[model samples]
Target: MTSTDTSDTSVLDDPVGESLRGRHAPLGRTLGRAAAYAQDVATFSAVPADPTAADWSDLARLLGPGAFADMFSCPALPPAGWEPVFVLEGRQMVWPDGGRPDPEPAATGPDVTELGKADVPEMLDLVALTRPGPFRPRTRELGTYLGVREGGRLVAMAGERLRPAGWTEISAVCVVPELRGRGHAGRLIGALVTRVLARGERPFLHVAEANTKAIALYERLGFASRKEVTFRGYTTP
Candidate 1:
């Protein structure tokens, strides 16, 4: 299952009605005239009163020359002629029912290791093998990441991403093909949820709407779908 997330409580039909237009948008990273990642951990999810020439220009400027971004927006994004690559309708799911910590599951495989910068090579290898999601070299700098290893090789892992005011997203969850059915992903998610709850925040995630298997697993783990989102990656011209 691929773990990830993008965007707000619910986007507004009127972008200027008080959400995206304000200096203090719900998203900490979004700034004046646009809300986007300065670090480019993920795409710039924005809400312009309308996708005007200037609005798109602001998005492009924030992204920089020829840089790409995966923009998550609501139903009506006017065609801005940005280069398109990957696009999908996704679900923003939140753990409204809270964490279900399994005491034994935390140590399911070999002891879970708190991964750090030194472990990025193995982490990137695992991510490449599993296709979890976009994990840049600096992505690890954001927050806590934990993994399970067997015989000195990373087998499974999970981590955090896209934090809004009161919610932290659990992302990059995957287990190597040879290590499936060992409950590794579940254990990692449980651990992440516990940490988020400890910090007085809720856990949330995003996944493709068609990813029924992962969605079912999350539903069983107390996550409820909050909104349908269109996650789009564009190569800025």
Candidate 2:
């Protein structure tokens, strides 16, 4: 991976917050310093960097009683009444400077197609089988999604999420278990990377630390680790 100045990484420190407040503002609900995506859009919620008591209260009110809040990579812990739901160790990886993917096969293959609302059912089915991450019915509304099909059945897919300032997150890159190691993921990600860079934004993604195979693929695709992160979720109190 090629080295580049990372002085502007502060925006990434609160990606969920930045996104909810910026490009995704219309798709989210904000209450004071607390904010979250609309129901069915995504489960991610956010608070100020140094959250106050009121911030937690606002988030709780926003999510209502006993709602699940996916605090993606937020460093602050919530109040005692908020129950921990899940936590995953992950890393933020960014496309390195001067890095570019070879032309994506999607450029020529009829199998690679842009997905839409009509594809959500199959997309959800794939997510259920792959456990890529949190993907709800409306999640695709967040950004562009692309999928690879085989004999008219969706098999592999990837898409954009969390547009934080000048960056776009490449997420939900998953392939069928039966089709593993076939370079489908790499192609999907490469296509998305090309699209992101073309629009004057950088590409980044999060991957579970235990998924070493994915980390290797990301590295091979010109992504370099920026920082370790803890993905946390909690129940609103």
Candidate 3:
């Protein structure tokens, strides 16, 4: 159900934390001010926007010593012993409120299919080939996923991730390299946007700032950049 007002955008600031505390609570763990998804689901972890030392300690304990923490877009810095892993520049884009576009006709219908547990193998293979983002073995458990197939092989896909209250993040949008330039990514995203809007939640997503092509496609589909984000990962000590 809807956990927050659809127009309230504050929850977008701490999406991972909001998701863990709201819709994704069943798939997450928390200790003090720290929370993380199940090991196989996602590597994301969250703490207060202005985290204290104890918050860092709690997160480290929750993840166990030396575990990797994918702190998606949280600008707070961790304690010294928390070694930096990787950092990437990205931006959060959201569907304009009340702007609903028709789902791409070809993307729906028989060509696009709802993906489930049995499709994980193929999904992983697609992710490996496309390098969309941090997709894990149990990532599909987060929300609905859809894929397009041709020649009886999966060629493209997109799906939801990080449900923060009334917002659903459309993520893992990828296509086989050979199939690039086709409208598969846009069509899959358009279909997902319709699905998210149909459920009364708004659709949002993050894209690496360097990926200009993807950004252009998303903008063309009516998404607007809400904020710039620096995605960071760290090793807990």
lDDT of 3 by residue, 1-237 (tens): 454578888999999999999899999999998999999999899998899999999999999988999999999998788899999999999999889976444443436789999999999999999999889999999999999998889999999999988899999999999988778888888888888888889999999999999899889889999999999999988
Q: Candidate 1 or 2, higher TM-score?
A: 2
Off by over 4 Å in 1: 1-32, 38-40, 43-52, 73-79, 97-107
Sorted by lDDT, highest first, which candidate order results?
Answer: 3, 2, 1
Q: Please, what are the lDDT tens digits per residue for candidate 2 over residues 1-237?
A: 212233367789999999999989999999999999998999899999999999999999999999999999999999899999999999999987546677534334436689999899999999999999999999999899999998888999999999888788999999999987777888888889998877767899999999999999898788999999999999988
Q: How many backbone overlaps does candidate 1 show?
A: 1
**Residue-level lDDT tens digits of model 1 in 1-237:** 112222335422322223233422333254345556445344445645555666667666766767775565434453556778778887888876445554443345578779998998898899899997877766665568999888998999999866555556788998999887777887788888888877776778888888887798787677888777776777766
What is the lDDT for 178 in model 2?
Answer: 95
Q: lDDT for every model?
A: 0.68, 0.89, 0.91
| Higher-scoring candidate on lDDT, 1 or 2 | 2
Best-first order by TM-score: 3, 2, 1
Q: Can you give the lDDT of residue 206 in candidate 1? A: 83
Stretches of candidate 3 exceeding 4 Å from the true structure: 1-3, 102-110
lDDT for predicted candidate 1 compared with the true structure: 0.68
Counting clashing residue pairs in each candidate, in order, gives 1, 0, 0
lDDT of 3 at 194: 83
Clashing pairs in 1: 30-35
